[model samples]
Target chain A: MNHNLPVLVLAFPLLAAFAVNLLGKISKKHVAPWTLASLILSAGTSLWVLKDVLQNGKFSYTVGGWMAPYGIELVLDPLSALMLVMVSWVALIATFSALPSIKKEMPGREHLFFSLYLILICGMMGLVITGDAFNLYVLLEITSITTYGLIAMGKGRAPLSSFNYIIMGTIGACFYLLGVGYLYLLTGTLNMADIASRLPALYESPTVATAFCFLIVGVWIKMAFFPLHGWLPNAYTYAPKGASVLVAPLMTKVSVFLMIRIMFSIYSPEYDFLMHLGIKNLVVWAATIAIVGASLIALTQKDFLKMLSYIVVAEVGYMVGGVWLANQEGLTGAIFHILNDSLMTLCFFLVASAIAYRTGSSRIADFRGLFQKMPLTMLALSVGALSVVGVPPTCGFFSKWYLLLGGVEAGQWEFVAALIFSSIVNAVLFYRVFEVAFSHSEEEPSLKFENSRILETSPMMIPPLVVIPVVLLVIGLSAGPLVREVIRLAVPAL
Target chain B: MDAWLFEIIGKFNYWIYVVLMMTGFYAMIRKNNLIKKLLGMNIFQTAIILLYISMGSKVGGKIPILDKEQALAGAVQVADVVNPLPHVLMLTAIVVSVSVTGVALAVALRIYKEYGSIDEDQILERIGKS
Candidate 1:
């Protein structure tokens, strides 16, 4: 049963995506419901797998019943288990919410949308599950290619944005392959555990150093560190609402996880030379720039989703900086922030999608009197916005708190400043939208605004309002316990 | 520095790998055409493939075709063979690289049809106006 589970998890989605693509010809009506149903079941199975992991400590399944170090292996420990559940849960919610939005937005591309969506989920899951380094790259490419396709489905300028994303993403994946090549050249192995055991002896060689550099740069691209993040804003802004909601939450976070695995697991912290290479300080500085720069840029955007796009860039910095701090608290904050930021970003983008659905625009100016126009959605948006601004009682605040504390504990005051600057900039950005949403439009309709419906948009408003707040509350309330657990799992990596 | 160069070049395979990587990177950065850029990406990917294959090499080793009779003879009595693992891995990586390139080319063709240009600057100009 254990031997079969990993293949089963991946096969279900792989088959479903292919089926959806084929079935779209039979009847377009069968596409959306079938896609959603498969995702719901996928999410349930992922949760069950997570439960099994938490209870059993760890489980290893050798693909094709072959032994490890030779055959493909799928290992599920707490970290990956947590990630699987997070990816699937967010994906399920995002997929369901996407239905009506895509229905209206793309009009003719819903079947393709659902198919690419399923493929993206499968790719992310494959990245999380596969214990082979080379296989992870294969899955990463799958995710990137499918994502570019999905992002291009947006109306205008989307294909251009998707084109830029393809260039950057291709470079990123190539860099990762190069890095893996370096490691394989040194050790002649692709399995993570095998490479881990073999790597320390070769650390003195300059080839190892080169490999380290290659790996870090590669993952940094995917993680979208400051200088390399040129492709992100447009990609997020111009993609369809469904694509943005789906990709924004998991894509960068998964890359960061791979980075953590490489930095700590593949090359353990006990490597004396790696510590002396000033890699930590380099990461700290890059992350600081990313945090402050992205936040400030986010403040300058007029479009609501574009502004949120820059915030996502800033959020990546927070996680990268947190992890690079290389201490228990720092690592814990980084890991916890993954969950926090994923949910928070999901909420933000979902609300944006809902607003876009209602107003047919995501321009800040168009949101004037949105509070009256779409009360439930705007309320949810406000909560999500406040969360992004890192206020208490929202998930965003707790993660930022730990991140700030981690900086101080590591005596990295500049990073603390970055976090504070990020907070202020986020506040400004969120408030700009909030003001428009709250203010009354000068030319009010003759009809009473109170006559406006309770829920603004169907299939869109409901998911964000329900899923976003509940996630926010859960993170805020259970932060202490969650932080403790993240710390435990992060120990091996840090 | 001379000693370093000699040592690096003496391993001709590593030198070839480095040259291939540099060529690919240069083309990717310098090329104006999308197809040229993708060709560069292919070259860049192939360099890694060479690197992996080179890694699996052993001094005076034969191809790793497992002989059931020889293996059963004894654990100590064995053919000194090159590692086949990296080669196998590279085959998978090559397939993935090609698939990504194929998909990317398809997207690029679609992009060209949509915007009526294949050059980055012109494409950007058209997209910007949109």
Candidate 2:
């Protein structure tokens, strides 16, 4: 079992999903705690895996003791271990916060929600840890299908949005499958390591190049990179408050991590395929447009959640641009941004869910005088907003700084400018919301304590909100250690 | 005639697959009906399955079941049997695609129940009116 920590982590939550359903049927009240307990166990296994990776370097676990190249293997490197921990950790908090909203939005289907949610965690873990390319496709489908179910749980327009997500997501996954098929055609193997080893001989072939393009495009669509991002805003905006908190922060991010893993691990960072075709420049330019364009689009949204969803689109640009910049700092920035952005988005989305829970609406107009009503919640929201705006002493600022430094090193001044411009745009967008929330109306005075009718949503919701921002601050302050100790180990040699 | 046989017949399977895949892609992207798009997604996935299964075939290859006599006598020649891995992989892919289609149709059903139409334009028009 110790040796099988990789599979155990997946099995713990997966098997527990059914157990949670059983508890929900028999007890109904015991389901949340059971889900949390299993997730905590999963998180513990993730940390164990992380510690082992950091101390002993990478290890691979073959299912049923079967050998690789023929049998499926789960690879636990520092990168995937870190992602496992992050996904589980955030998922744990998201589940805790979910109880309040799930009960409200989906009273009867609570077990079903947890079941799909746990399966999503299982699938994401499989996607991250699996060393085989085709296995990744299967795991990707599992995550996608479960997410569509979770999203459609929303009250209005959610089913439609989820339907849209299904179309795009299926196309993306199938494109990836097609690409894997091409890779198999050239190399006669579907294991990533095996394919990478055999690929150097075929690097100049058009089929290989086409396969690469298919993969990048597929990943881009899944990540919702700017032009391909149409399906994201609606799916996230209209999803049940509980569901968005779970799906928004992790799905696109894990997809981006898979992109990085595909490029760096399955295909070596120094493969030069990116540079040979000047695809790096193309991706970088697209990232630039994505940052600026998505920010502008974000500013136009009056719905608070919709606006943040657009910010998610813009932040996706940051990571994509950083990775495509093709320098060490850029790569580190991209990878680090994945961590920072997930935390930031989680904090903000939780805040959105909490406010929606209390106020019964998520529009900007609903936020009026919110600072007076739920001061602690608003404080948490302020931290998340400032982080998105790249203010210092928050995790977002450090990642943005690294991204800027990366852009400078790469001499991609346009991307650098876009990053800086996005920070300002984010600041303005958040400030606009703040202005609405912090205003003093006739009913709510500037210094009236407890005068407004607003109260904090619940004890459960504030913990994740406060805890996430604190984690953000800690990660921001210890940025050097995290980069030197964790991210660098995960990134392959350039 | 031999050249024609080797070239045309050799590549026609892939050509048919390309046609099938494009039709799926076209319907998925261009069709106004949600159900049609779902159908298109199915076509696209099936085309891919066909492509993989076809790639696993060899003209002279037999079924992948092991011959006990040959196994006892010597190491089996792999080229004598068609590849079985793609078949197994596509089995998984087909299961996944079926799940996707089921979930997609369910969501579409819900959408239709809510909006009274499954046409993309009508849904958009309805939303605009609302």
Candidate 3:
């Protein structure tokens, strides 16, 4: 049972996805409990796997008892194990808010939505755990296809945005497949470790370089890294509240994790960082522009959800830039930021959904006097805002600090400047929203609830919004130990 | 010049696939109609599938199945057998592409229902007016 835990972490949600759909045919009410129970089980199993990994160092499980290099394998190193925990737990927490939001916003599509939701979670979990390059491509498609379905389920312009995403996402996944094909042609192996072991001798070949470029570019498009980010803002902004809360936090973060795996695991640091110093510099500079540019664009958005989506783009820049800084600290910050950013983004999206549920608008102007109407929700937003701005005592501050240290150490002053610039822009953006929400407006009345007895937000929604901010503070305070124990182990030796 | 010509002709398969890929990529980017874009995506994926299939093929290679008598006699050379892994991988890729195309068409249908037009410009113009 202990040996099977890693696969079990994935199996629960994959099985639950089909089960939920079938059960939904009988009654819609079974969907939420079924999805949540499976996610909880998956998260618990992931934590157990993380504990087992930390103790035993690293291990790989070959599917069907076949040996590595030939059969599909699921690897559980500190990094992947940590990512499993993060992805599962975040999926679980996001579902708490997602349930009520789906019920309210989607209305009667709960079964279908939750079914795709579980499958998306399963895909992300499989992505982090799988050791085969070809397997990763399949899981990427699974995630992308489910996300497209979820996004298109939204009313109005959503299907259009999802269609655009489908085009870009397919291109990205195909590029990755093409890259893997090139690698297989050269190395004759689809297993990641096998490919890596065989890659050093062929590092100087242009085919190898081209393959690396394709893989990185593919992941960048998937993660919405700057120039390839055109599909993100609109697709995420127009998605139904339930879907956005889950996809916004997990999708890009998992892709960044994939990039890290490719960089340090598949291709050695000597080849990625040392041999390609020129390309490294170019990517870092692009990340710098992505950070500053996305933040500036985010500042220009009047719709609050659109602004948050752009912030997600800039946050991607932070992780990408940090990783490209090519130091231990930078990698640590990048991995740690994956955890912190996902939590904070979940917090913000949950709060946005709750507010939208009440007020029926996401425009900044419509948020006037919301603080009085929804105090707890507003407080959660404040916590999330401070975290995004990298204020101290939230998890965001620690990761940004590590990223800054890495930038300074690497002598990338422009990237460092961009980081600081984006944080300030975030501060201004959140402040403007807060100022509107807090200020008393004589012309506009406070938002009225349909039922006087009910709370500001749904009971289902309130728990995650409240829990996430607390988790942020807890993670912030324990950053030192987390870095020393887990994240440090997760970072590849540079 | 003779060697360069030989190189181009010898690897002409790759060149053809790259051309096909570029054409699909062009349509995916430049086409106005959503259905055309979807077709472009299919073309792009099919080109990749063909590229992978080409990689598994050899000029004089047999299908991966082995003759038991030849295998027992130890007369089968590894090079004589065409690689089967790429073919199998492409099968999975084909399924994924089909699913992606199916989802794309469904979304395209939804887009038409919502905006009453499938052309990018018309949809955007409608969105702006609304």
Candidate 4:
């Protein structure tokens, strides 16, 4: 049972997805509990797997008793084990906040939403653990298709945005497939470890070069890095609040994880940094542009959720840029940021969804006097906002600090400047929202404290909201140990 | 020049796939109608499928099967059989493509119902007005 923990982590949610759909035929009430139980089981197993990997070094599990280099393999190094734990636990927390939103937004479709939701979680779990290049593409599509379905369930303009995402996402997936095909043609193996072993000799070949470009670009498009990010903001913004809360935090961050996997696992740092020096600088520059541009745009948004979407765009820039800095600190910051950014994004989106759930509005103007109306939710938003702005004692600040240190070491002053500028812009953006929420307006007397009792959101939403801020600080205070123990082990030799 | 021509002709399958993929990509980006974009996406995915299938084929190679007696006697030769992995992989790809098409069509149908048109320009106008 201990040996099979990796497969069990994926199996729980996948089986629960089917169970939820079937049981919903009789009653919709079973969907939430079933989904929660499966995610908890999956997350629990993932944590156990992480503990095992940490206690003992890395290990691999072959699917069904078939051997590697032929059958599918699930590799559980510290890196992937950490990612598995992150994706599962984040999905679990997001689901807690999502249930009530789903209940309120689309009442009768609870089972359908959670069914797709659980499958998406399963797909992400599979994605982080699978050792086959082609299997990653399949799991990517599974996550993507379910996301498209979940987003299209929104009331208006959502189907259109989801359709656009399908176009971009399919192109990205196909490009990745084409790259894997090229690798297979050269190495005659589908396993990532086997391909990596064979890649050294073929590094100088033009075919190898083309495959590398295709793979990186494919992943970039999926993660919404810079110019390829056109599909993200709209798809996320227009999605149902429940779906957005889950998808917004996890999707791009998981794709960033894939990029890191490709860079370190399949192709070594020597190949990525030394051989392709020009391309490395080019990517960092692109990340700089992404950061500055997205932050500037984020400052101009009037809608709260739309603003957060652009900030997501900038956070992708941070991770991508950090990786391209091509040093130990940069890579560590990037991997650590994957964990921190996902939690921070989840925190922000949860608060946004909670606000939208009770008020039926996400406009900044509607947030006026929200502090008086819902003090706890506003406090969560404040903590999330400070984290996003890179305030000290929060998880976001430490990752940004590593990123900045990495940028300075690499002498990429532009990237460093861009990171600082984005942080300031984030500070301004959140401050504006806070100012609006705190100010008293005489025109809207209905929102005044005297008119109505101050009420928080539903009981369902409060737990995750409270849990995330504490987790952020806990992760923040322990950043030193986390980086030294897990992340340092995860980073491949430079 | 002749060597270049021979090289191009030798991998004519890949060239054709590149052409198909680009055509589909263009339609996906450049076309106005949502259905046309979906059609382009199909063409793009099909080209990839064909590329993978072509990769699996070998000259004069038989289906990837082993004779029972030959396997027992340890006389099977790898060169005699074509690769089966790519085909199996592409089978999954085809299933994914079909699922994607189904989802895209469903989303397009919803778009048509909501805004009363699937044209990109018209949908934009409607969204703007709304």
Best candidate (score: lDDT): 3
Minimal lDDT window, size 10, model 1 chain A:
A445-454
Per-residue lDDT of A351 in model 2: 91
Q: List the residue pairs that clash in candidate 4.
A: none
Candidate 4 stretches greater than 4 Å from native: A272-275, A445-454
Clash pairs, candidate 1, are none
DockQ, cand. 2: 0.90
* Maximum-TM-score candidate: 3
Where model 3 places Cα greater than 4 Å from the true spot, the runs are: A272-274, A446-453, B1-4
Comparing candidate 2 with candidate 3, which one achieves the higher lDDT?
3
- Residue pairs of candidate 2 with colliding backbone atoms: none
RMSD of candidates 1 onward, in order: 2.9, 2.4, 1.4, 1.8
Candidate 3, DockQ score (0 to 1): 0.93
Which CAPRI level is candidate 4? high
Candidate 2 wrongly placed segments (more than 4 Å): A441-454, B1-8
How good is the docking of model 3, by CAPRI class?
A: high
Q: Of the true contacts between chains A and B, what fraction does model 1 have?
A: 0.53
Each model's lDDT: 0.81, 0.89, 0.92, 0.91
Cα lDDT tens digits, model 3, B1-130, are: 9999998899998888998899899999999999999889998998999899998999899999999999999999988889999999999999999999999999998888888998999999999999
Q: Judged by DockQ relative to the true structure, which candidate is superior, 1 or 3? A: 3
| Candidates, ranked, TM-score | 3, 4, 2, 1
TM for candidate 3 is 0.98
| Residues A92-194, model 2: lDDT tens digits | 8888788888887778889988899899989988888899999999999999999999999898899999999999999899899999999999999988989
**A393 in model 4: Cα distance from truth in Å?**
0.8
lDDT of 2 by residue, B1-130 (tens): 8997888777998888899999999999999999999999999999999999988999899899998998888778888899998999999999999999999999999999999999999999998899
